[model samples]
Target: MTVKTFKQGVFLPHYKKYSEDQPITTIDLPNEVVIPLHQHIGAPCQALVRAGDRVKTGQKIGESAAFVSAAIHASVDGTVTAVEPRPYFTGTNVESVVIEVDPEQKEPVWPEQDLSSLDKDAIKAAIKEAGIVGMGGAAFPTHVKLSASKPIDAVIINACECEPFLTCDHRLLIEATAALVEGARLIRKVVDAPRVYFGVETNKADGIAALKQAIKDDETMEVVMLDVKYPQGSEKQLIKAVMDREVPPGKLPLDVGAIVQNVSTAIAIYEACRYKKPLYERVLTLSGDAAARPGNIRVRVGTPIGHIIEQCGGFKGASGEEARLNKLVGKIIMGGPMTGWAQSRLDIPIVKGTSGILIFSPAMVAKTEHRACVRCGRCVEHCPMFLYPSHIGMYAENGRYDSAVEWGAMDCFECGICVYVCPSNRPIVKFVRETKRHVAAARAAKAK
Candidate 1:
């Protein structure tokens, strides 16, 4: 009966009704896919297969020698058309492998592996080889995360899809409950943890119920209901809410005897360990007011956003006309509204970190130019990280990167809560990003 929660977060409209009841549907393989080599936080992968090479589904197409990088696999049986720079969801050009999907494609048959016999190292190796990353959008290589130096006491499964209009994780809980449970156990074993916790929000009653029923007989796992709050699914906040462990300002969950993985990430880990299947595809919610048909879809990682939009019934205007013709579609976001990137064009392809593709009509999109910080202090009161975003924004705006750093710019995860609550409509997340770039560049220069 005790619903656990973290401190300092904003309450917002769920906006999940559009796709929460919809079942997970698989989209047809896109004709061509642009698989970016740099989808994670670390070093980008080098193209393993050059143009004109034939690749099968689940084949490793890109890899890197860096310990922080995860491999990139071909999501479909296809012929590589090019290995060149392409537009990415981040509004930048990244080297990508473009593949033309073969028409006569068949389901990939992965050799079943004996999951019971795999040890901790074997499990970690399998995860890394499969190219599995944090499917909740952080895109941190999962294997690197499981390599905890500190002893871990528990593993928390983040089922709190707290971002507005995202129901893919909730659907995964209902449809892939068994896989999620198995994946949690695998993660716990890797960290040598004794227990697993599922941190879910109260809004997802069905998902919570399904998880509870699935873990009823398991003593090592339990479901922890979390309050429905924005940014509740963030790594540090989830750890705090579920395990009541505060990860230090510059530390990770493992530092506090816990490891947190998203719901979709857990499912990917299970598939990789049990079937030796690579993480080439994932489930994401396609929903917004402008989307003609909104639903949760299982899609390949490299599918183009344009192709996905057309296949998902295209865009619709307010009066039921084509949105493009009316210029009614204002924004296309690559992830959740809170932390997702605002896309300029639809030519970019979805990557491993993409959690959703949201299309919003002009009427639903707010058009406002960010003004100077009003010093109203709402951003400070509501920030889940409890940092002075106003000061950080002001410092970054004035090109004072060191001052921004002192104001905790590096510690910020850019959840956008500060911007959401800002009365002056100041773009705090943008300032934080700019500050981080400058600080990182300065550090590199100093090291040189």
Candidate 2:
């Protein structure tokens, strides 16, 4: 079925050709991995192991008491080298467990299990025990997402792959169709949703076709092709497109009687249910002009970006020579260029949220200066949430925290569309984020 299109969305340059056609390959274990204790949205997990302690794959190393938080597992069989603070993607240094791989260690194996006889509760238990989270950037615990307290009319499987140069979801939809479907069934049973819908952007025709074939025998499952646009895969946006339901501000999909899960998260659910394997590895797209062999590789969570690039035939041109000869000016980014974070160091290990590792050569990295807002209304026009970014920016600049919140700054999805279309490059998203932080702090203080 063809899904309905939304009113506002932008079509940015998609540099996906770099690795779209290439199949996913697996990268060998790295010599060392830095496992941050805090990789999810809630409170950071406390360390369960100390330095110099031996660990095996799937062993839980970090756990938290917060109900919203998820657990962290050891990605490789190795010795804990350190249990100290380190640079994490959250823009702050946090305590992490660093493991040095035992090169002679054999590949980890999963314990045999019978899943065909298990029920929905067993599946949820397996997912929670395995520490699985959303792999499509949100990093929310999968078990929590699948377990909804309210009634769910339908379940939406997000396969849009809207961001540029990231084909991890697309490849998974193509290769792991059966697993995704089974995971969707499990989610349906858990949420008690009678119907399931798979939403994919039209750009991924192959994926849509594969999913359709996989669900052909299932009468309750339907595949809907969405208009190709940025942020199409976002929960609220996709819900609107596929189900024509508007999730009110500050409300979750459950409130509107829907639940969304990513394709990779579904695959992880299947593995957890059928094989009892924790989410220690994931498919990551290694691409850009700096890479010699651009493609997707199934990399262990702790595998370093430097090692992944080397396995992908190393960097290309002067970047390659400089990387091989001496450290250079090229920038490395995690996830899509639009919403992804630029890394100052390449030694950071791949976390569960990582979908792609983009290597931009010095020449390709554009360092644009921030300018004032031009009031062109492009940001407003392109915002998926239809909020006034100009007003939010002005309020943020004037330090009017209350006014910014009143102007619906919290509704901003931070999809970077405002930052992308601003002619003056005013970094509107950054200001909105700051305003959100201030507002959140104020609310917290008020609660006290």
My TM-score estimates for the predictions, one after another, are 0.98, 0.95
True-structure RMSD, every candidate? 1.5, 2.1
lDDT of all predictions? 0.91, 0.85
TM-score of 2: 0.95
Kindly list the per-residue Cα lDDT of model 1 for residues 1-448, writing each as its tens digit.
9899999999999999999999999877888998999999899999999999999999999999999999999999999999999988877899999999999898988788888999999999999999999988999999999998899999999999999999999999999999999999999889899999999999989998999999999998999999999899998989888888889999878778988899999999999999999999999999998888899999998998888888888886443235566788888899999999998777789988889999897877878888887778999999999999999999899998899999999999999999999988999899999998888888899999
Model 2 lDDT, full chain set: 0.85
TM-score of 1: 0.98
lDDT of 2 by residue, 230-306 (tens): 88988999999998999999999999999999899988988888888888889989888777889988988877777
Question: Which window of 10 residues has the lowest lDDT sum in candidate 1?
Answer: 316-325
C-alpha lDDT of residue 68 in model 1: 98
